[model samples]
Target: MIPFSLLDYVALFWYITFWLCFSWVVDHSRLKHHNLSHLMNGHRLRWMRNMSTRDLRMVDTAIISGLQNGTAFFASTSLLAIGGGFAMLNSTERAIQLFSDLSIPVETTRALWEVKVLFLILIYVYAFFKFGWAYRLFNYSSILIGALPYAKTADEQELEIAIRQAAEFNSLAGKHFNLGLRSFFFSLALFGWFVHPGLLIVTTTFVGLVLIRRQYFSRSQTLSMHLLPEKE
Candidate 1:
């Protein structure tokens, strides 16, 4: 049995609550439309709508390829992080020794260390699955793009439907990719757990705030929401 105290439970509970609430605020809140992710979603819709007017689609295919490549990189990184976690589990004594002299909030134990490392591995695994699914969705979007009819030959209604379908698939892929990256950021906060439960709570709160700011108040968000003049 792992030796965990009341403080550990409280810290873990807060960590989970912060993560869930942050996810909701970014992806489902009433003001989510003002965020960077929502802005990019609109850009994706416009990109697909414009694709319908072009005779050649090489530009569209290249952009999809880039999305797939980015997703694949993150998936591979998750696997590597998982392997590192297992390696730490095998060297549990060394990790405990390294922290033995530090003035930490809690004493280190083999069982507790193992649990922390396992949680880290679990997070990366979740990210890997998300990236994998996002990659496949990008592939589906590419196929949908290929299926779009030429604007000159297709009926107006059919072209509109095809454009909407392609845009939706692309947007869904972006959402999953964002989720995978979110896991990676939170996993960094987990390091504070190896030191102290109180520190863990503080670190998680800080990371959550940073993510929220980037999504809603960063320069990128401001720039993404900007539009060019329609005419001179």
Candidate 2:
């Protein structure tokens, strides 16, 4: 078995640290208001509120249907990825043999390759559960949407509570879906571990930076900001 090195441990730790910190900052920190998720969440709240005012809500239901379809797609993709990971484990010996013949220096130890494959499987498992739960949340949100009374007949306070519930469920579903996508991004970084621990660090950092940029500084964020009527 190829023994794990101290640098490998450090790289894994850094990957976890960055993922956790980035998630917290994006979801809970004061700076979150500046993130695209926060902006989109406001949109969600508005959508639920506006939905209450409408008697013909086919459009709103259609939007929820779209969201559910997207979440189900991701959930299915995560399952496929997990199956692929297990297949990789089954082929580790052949994979190591194939890599050893390559000119580039590659770590070709069976145990090390197995460990990497197992970690990849675990990441996919995490993502699958996240997506699964997100799909359920979206389902619940749709039910809540149907429960929403026409604004013309609803008591103001009761309608406010119902709208909030629908919006919160929708937002929560989106949050979990984003997290599953984050796992997908980090799983790409996990690919670097197949070559070298140092490369793992480099790839993880690149993924983290890309996520930050897209959330906080990308042109998409600018477009999202334009959708909001006022600053959060």
- All models: lDDT? 0.91, 0.92
Best by TM-score: 2
- lDDT by residue (81-176, candidate 2, tens digit) is 999999999998899988899898987578888888999999999999999999999999999999998999989999999998999999999999
Model 1 bad stretches (over 4 Å) = 101-106, 228-232
User: What TM-score goes with each of the models?
Assistant: 0.94, 0.96
True-structure lDDT of candidate 2: 0.92
Give model 2's TM-score versus the native structure. Answer: 0.96
lDDT of 1 by residue, 71-151 (tens): 999999999999999999999998888788667544789999999999999999999999999999999999999999998
- What local lDDT does model 2 show for residue 196? 88
Candidate 1: lDDT over CA atoms? 0.91
